[model samples]
Target chain A: MLKSINVPRHDRVPSLIPDTQASMTRQEIANNNWEEALTFVALQRDRSAYAELFSYFAPRLKAFGMKMFGNEQQALEMVQDTMLNVWKKAALFDASRGCASTWIFTIARNVRFDMLRKKQSRKDDVSADDLWLNGEYPEQEADTDASQWDTQLLMEKLAPHFASLPPAQREVMERVYLQEKSHQEVSDELAIPLGTVKSRIRLALDRLREALDGARN
Target chain B: MAHAIKFHPGMSLLEQHAEGSLSADVALAVAAHIDLCPHCQQLSRDITADLACQLTQQPVKTNTTDWQHMLNDIMAQPQLSKQAAATQAQLSAQAAEPIIVNQREFVVPRALQRLAANHGKWLHLGGIATAKLPAGNDYHVSLLYISKDTEVPQHTHLGLEMTLVLAGKIVDENGEYKAGDLLINSPDDTHTPRTMADEDCLCLSVLSAPLKFKKGLTRLLNPLQQFFY
Candidate 1:
């Protein structure tokens, strides 16, 4: 017999994003073209636009790293590495290929991967970027729609849909994606079977996929 | 491209890849598979977009002074010119020459090209060849080549084994796998994989643990295990 456990309501609540702040952020995000900000930083070496991006992404990246590292100092280091890469590789950011948020998220993910490998003393000839962000693959020719990759718009539409998910499903999603825990780790932590964790994840993904497609259509 | 890919990494694996939660070596197999399977490529992009939305939504505890300090340092760094970036990409592309084994040259997936270029010398056995790639400590990553009309000894996995076909076809007891197909075998699975009589095959294999040959001569088993691991 499996025992039921109470899941913490951390970070996945719809009420956390109050409507007033959501509207304000939406207006600000609409007026500001993050893609253009990246372009300006690339072409003209614009410091203001760079600063704007830093103010927006740094805190979130710090939060992202915190789950992986569990230490504020190491999390800060991840933020530094990721932001520096964004600055140096700004010219490589192609808006047609992906949105600004997706691009930065890739950079952050790669940096964190490298950091973990380094800590493990795993000397790998294949870098994280080589695996995750290969350049030789054919350009994703289909679905070049700009709106599909818009981060802020998706976030706005996704907030309530994500919040409406059952608490059990939401807990699995947070553990797997936000906390960077593997399915096996989630299973062990929750005292559930491995198959159960995978099923919950699949079901949660199904619901989120439906919600996203509904919003898209 | 001769046959439609019949196998792929599971949905949970793809989701883990998008989350960047899977270990580097396991994620490599998924990345290479996605390079050939456009359907999965699209799925990966959608998942990534969703991940980005969720990630950026976390309410951050802002330390204004610290953020300002880091921002100043990052802003002071010089940015790469578009031309320089393009040149860098071109140079890396040029470096990834085709992989050659047993008098055959096979173009591996884009995700595998860089690491494959650095693969160790190919070691030959009866009708198979294996070249080790630099990978994480927990997994043994290599390029496995099967010559025409060859059969690997029957074995059961001690742990997970992931194989992605880069050229030609392979058949086990369960099914036939063609190029772009990803085969995942757990410890419970036991089978003998072989190549066709006239067609050779090449694969990217990531093994979490060594294979335990079940049906071969006991004396040959140790060497065979040594050969693979």
Candidate 2:
């Protein structure tokens, strides 16, 4: 089931990529083909591709877990569980349907959901995968007509609009998505009202949507 | 005949659902609604894709933990073959059991299938029946069936009350609800929910607290609450 990959690991070291969106040159952004890397891991069982993915995602996931769980041990556990799922569920990834980051993010989110359920000792009859990963309804899958948006182009177009948002809106966006904080938690953390937090998020989404839709038109 | 779905979860709720930040019990209602409503499904997909776009752009803090060892350990584990994954998907699809109520069969959304399979025995009172689906502790999740022309007593919620219509039609003071309509009621809202004279109804109900029946006999209110809870 596995074949060796010829791609060299040194050609795509994730560590060399800069941290900020502004600092990332076009070459770096263009080279970020996590979707293709995942295909290699799936079809070729390419350890080098997997390692490159790990280098790019693990620290970010660690930061994500720390923000969500507020401890190092649980964060590390999350990284391990998420990465393991990435390896095991690689065959399920479809590049045409979605990007690698979104697919990986969903896996990470489901891992966190399961961990939360286990910590609460809740009955495991219904799982996050059942609720999130499966088709919303069995018949609905047959009628799915559109492929996902071209993610690389969307990302490139969205970065400037995202950066230009008001500081409060940008901060709320980061806390909600990156930190995975609930709106209520963000309200409490930022010392703002819940309504304010919600409105800011709404406005931020509107601006980003307009930017993308503009490009499409 | 299928009725066009009119009521849907608000955009904020849809966004929260895509983020996986909503509690499981609440998220179940949204997911099931998305099953029946194509509009929300598309909106949810867009929101999730946008989230992915934003998430990828977030700056990462450098951490020095030995993720190398963790990666090596993960690499050592056996990857699931495509055949095995396909088999699992097939098993789940085949395992979906139709929910039966009052000699009538109702097909629930995929999200509720597993928990609905293990639901408790139906408890009947008057023309209404409810069966508890074991899910979260803080909320009461159940399948509620109301026979034709039956009217539930007027009640106000103490916390949150979310109802997702699965089959047939129901009408309240506000408007008519057909299949795939999700009604979210907070503490301040009070209304009587009833079925049409010619149609029966089935709903997925989630309650944060027991109902407080209004405008009923003082001695009979507790039993009325018990009927639904």
Best by TM-score: 2
Candidates' chain A TM-scores: 0.53, 0.53
* DockQ, structure candidate 2: 0.20
The positional error of residue B53 in candidate 1, measured at the CA in angstroms, is: 1.2
**Model 2: per-residue Cα lDDT over B23-58, one tens digit each:** 888988888888888766756765665565555556
Candidate 2 has an lDDT of 0.74
Locate the minimum summed-lDDT window of 10 residues in model 2 chain B: B85-94
Candidate 1's C-alpha runs over 4 A off are: A1-27, A30-32, A122-124, A134-217, B89-92, B216-219
What is the number of backbone collisions in each predicted candidate, taken in the order shown?
0, 0
Clashing pairs in 2: none
DockQ of 1: 0.20
Q: What fraction of the native interface does candidate 1 get right in terms of contacts?
A: 0.43
Taking the tens digit of each residue's C-alpha lDDT, what string does model 1 give over A144-199? 34225444554566556768676766887678766779888986776444444555
Supply DockQ values for each candidate: 0.20, 0.20
> What's the C-alpha lDDT at position B129 in model 1?
94
Error of 1 at B108 (Å): 1.4
Candidate 2 runs further than 4 Å off: A1-32, A135-217, B89-93
